[model samples]
Target: MKNVVITGTSRGIGLELVKLFAEEDFNILALSRNAEPVSSIELDNVSAFSFDLGTEVDLKKASDFVENEWNGKVDILIHNAGAFLNKPFQETALEEFRRIYEVNVFGLIGLTQQLMPFMDSSSHIVSISSMGGVQGSMKFAGLSAYSSSKAAIITLTELLAEEYKESGPVFNVLALGAVQTEMLAEAFPGLEAPLSAAEMASYIKNFSLTGSKFYNGKLLQVSNSTP
Candidate 1:
């Protein structure tokens, strides 16, 4: 069985992704700030733990789990946790902006660096980004902090893919448009997204399993509607 580590497994697409993987009997480590939801499921192939990307202790815990339990073999790593701030650029405080970057950018960088050792050439690192982050995509008014931070990860993914191209562990990012997720509702109240969380999760699961064979360091735009 393939060992997979997924962040943000408490809710939204992340939670759904965990369920789909568990159904397939993948050895999964599901990391979320609130572990109860996943833990309550109690699947034998799945392990749930509280993890905060900004915390060194939490990162270390995940690394230790991979090292000790999975024997340092991670077939797939999904960076799905995100921080959203829906406020005017001028109104968004410096700390709030930093918080967004902490989870969406710096935190991702930290986690990838921590787990990179456990990943080999066959491993795949898939990051979830936003369509607003894509250059020349439809820009949003109140997502300055959230969107820009997401853009950072898109570039980071490309850079890592190039750096590790010869060795392995492909890196790719998906720039999603809009999904009917809690984060989306929080960011754009009353807006109906074209896709549901489960629908997007299924797509991500399939891509994580096979996208590496055809693409690396590439950004796939997975949006049907402009947000």
Candidate 2:
């Protein structure tokens, strides 16, 4: 079986991803603040680590611990821990931008950097992005903060994918369309996602485990009904 690591496993897509992967019998190193309550992760195949991604210290420590914690094995790494804030470009606070990018950008990079020491050849790193990253849809009005942050994620993923091309591991960003999750409702209240979180998780596990053939480092949209 494969060993996987996922961030933001407390709820939403992260939680769903953990659930699906666990059901598939993959050993998971799940990270989040409140993961103890998750029954799915209580099994022998799953282990939870509680830590806030905003701090660089936590990233370093968690990565080190997970390396030893998982017996130095990880086949897939998923950077799914993220936050969302919707507001006009003007009203968006610089601190808000910092906070959003802290978890979405710097923090994710920090954690990945530390985790790489443990990952062997032929592993995959999947960063969960958004459709907002690719297009300036009508959704761009109040999503300046959220969209811009995800855009940064895509750019980062691309840059890292290139750096890790010949060596290191496979790095790809999944520009997932709106899925039933708290982050979506925060951006657009009362709007339902075309896909459920479980469906999204199913697709992610399948796509992430594909052959190491290097696809162009770009954002990918996840469609559950068909992938």
Candidate 3:
């Protein structure tokens, strides 16, 4: 079975991804702030790590655990953890931006760097972005901070793909549309999403495992309609 490392597995798309991979018997290293939810899954293939992306201690512990458990041979690494804020640009405090950036950008880079040693030539690194991050998308009034972070994700993935071009470990970004999840609900209250978390998770599984072969350093936009 292939080994997969996923962050933000406590709920929503991350949780669904964990369930899908666990059912397929893939060895999964699941990182999340809360462990109880993931522990309830009762799958031997799933190992839940209580991790707060904004915390240095948690990142170090997770890195150590991964080093001991999988060595340096991760088949797939998915950076799915993210933070979202839905305040107007002016009202959004600097602290809010810092908090979101810490999780969505800094934390992501830290974990990816820590795990890079384990990734091989055949490995794939997938970063989850947002449609709002894409230029010309329907920009909402209160998504400035969140959208900017996701935009950063796309650029970072592209840079990594080029950096790793000659060696291996393909990199790609998935710019997803609104999915019916807690985060989406929180971001846009009362707005119904066309896609569900389970459906998104399935697509993510297929992409990470196989479909990523079609492209490298590309931002694939996924949504109910063209964004």
Candidate 4:
């Protein structure tokens, strides 16, 4: 009977999460820039919605629809749609940085704020971050745009957890090391191997429902192999 609303459901972790959770009978509200199959004979519990999070107009519409459709109660809100611009700090353009933050930070905050009223005592807010967000990693070059934004997101989640404590919702971040998704291919193309998206999605599912009891507010890290 959990009501779940997930943004950025077109591809990568977001898409995998949508399909995986819908199969489990959670009432799903899926929003993405790309079209998702709606009214499926197979997935009767899914209501697929599409909108670009980088723009304000699209986000307003998405918020209105989701708020009305979900009817002022969301047990879980997963902010999984984000982007990475893999240019060195020197080469990264201001516009590219803006685009990265547009999706990673601004859009995410916008959607969360719009849905905040619906978050009740038991609501859970989960954001996907990265190990890059962790303190000064192994000196990887040309990831300034991504790492910085993710680091900020991690802090944002923590602060949000404190800010909304009265509502009893748990806002947290997951600094997953690396997973096989389109984002990975784009961020670091030609990698020999990476963790499968479905496998990671499964871990997220299990963790959210159970491990969360012991793991709230901690930057839970999960991978095929630990870094």
| Candidate number of the best TM-score | 1
For model 4, what is the alpha-carbon lDDT of residue 7? 79
TM match of model 2 to true structure: 0.91
TM-score of each model, paired residue for residue: 0.99, 0.91, 0.96, 0.90
TM-score of 3: 0.96
Q: What is the TM-score ranking, best to worst?
A: 1, 3, 2, 4
| RMSD of model 1 against the true structure | 0.6
Ranking by lDDT: 1, 3, 2, 4
- Each model's lDDT comes to 0.94, 0.79, 0.88, 0.76
Off by over 4 Å in 3: none
Off by over 4 Å in 1: none
1-227: candidate 2 lDDT, tens digit per residue = 88888898888878888888888788887888787755554788888867788777778767777667777667888898888887888988899989888888887888888888777568888898877776653355777777788888888888987887777687888887778888877877887778888888878778778834556365787644211
Clashes of 2: 0
Q: Model 4 misses residue 84 by how many Å?
A: 1.6
Question: Could you tell me the lDDT of residue 140 within candidate 4?
Answer: 56
Of models 2 and 4, which has the larger lDDT? 2
- lDDT comparison, 2 vs 3, better candidate: 3
4-28 in candidate 3: lDDT tens per residue? Answer: 9999998999999999998888999
Evaluated at residue 138, the lDDT of candidate 1 is 87
